[model samples]
Target: MAPYEVLYGRKCLTPLYWTELSEKQIHGVALVRETEEKVKVIRDCLKAASDRQKPYAYLKRKEIEFQIGAKVFLKVSPWKKILRFGRKGKLSPRFIGSYEVIERIGPVAYRLALPTELERIHDVCFMCRCCDDIVLIIHM
Candidate 1:
């Protein structure tokens, strides 16, 4: 059986089985046992695939850790908080604030000390937007 059938607990009807009919003799406890075995096999295969692909996924990625009081710029997602009161969002800067990191909520989330002006938005933000150096002046 394919992994799809094993995980989803359903038989896949493909062109290979177009002319075949399901065996009606297998029933009751036997059918339940068969399904259980398929589920076990599916779990093992999924874990193996994840282990094999994990290293490649992190090849070029660098993990960044933020400490309390560290300054970071909050990314401006156009969908998250709309700023189109009167001006166009395309003309607005893509990022806002060099806010200080006030608290760590979880492994990947942080709470920033946003200004009173930005009290409307949520305090918690992901680490992907926590950049230290806003811009390094490159001397031409």
Candidate 2:
């Protein structure tokens, strides 16, 4: 069942679709036929969107994995508003670990064996990209 149905204990009643449209209202055909045409148009739009998104998403979707004993680089960045990495933008390292992945919390989160210096910092790996993932590839 849908979330709306589960929440309200019944199917949702929207103002636009409060009552069913009869066949004789606008189109000469039955209501089902008219709705079917609308559904086809919506499906076509959704398919077009999916087709465009597939290649774009797949380009950045790296299948990166590490075994229990393997080490993965933990990202080093400013977490709080007051924290600063200084004005040297060109020299700062983006990721700071070969910190061991002690436990896999979930698909995205990992429990890293952080250094004593970073003990107060959270062990969870933030998956979102700091900058845009897209890169311009000039093929010869």
Q: Pick the candidate with the highest TM-score.
A: 1
Query: Residue 80 deviation, candidate 1, in Å?
Result: 1.9
For 32-96, candidate 2 gives per-residue lDDT tens digits of 57667767888999999999999988897775655565566656564431253443455655555
Which pairs clash inside model 1? none
Give every collision pair in model 2: none
Give the deviation of candidate 2 from the true structure as CA RMSD: 12.9
lDDT of each: 0.67, 0.61
Off by over 4 Å in 2: 1-51, 78-84, 126-140
Cα-based lDDT at residue 84, candidate 2: 36
Q: Which 10-residue window of candidate 1 scores lowest in summed lDDT? A: 131-140
Question: Any runs in candidate 1 off by more than 4 Å, and if so which?
Answer: 1-22, 76-78, 81-95, 105-109, 128-140
Show how many residue pairs clash in every candidate, following the order shown.
0, 0
Judged by lDDT against the true structure, how good is candidate 2?
A: 0.61
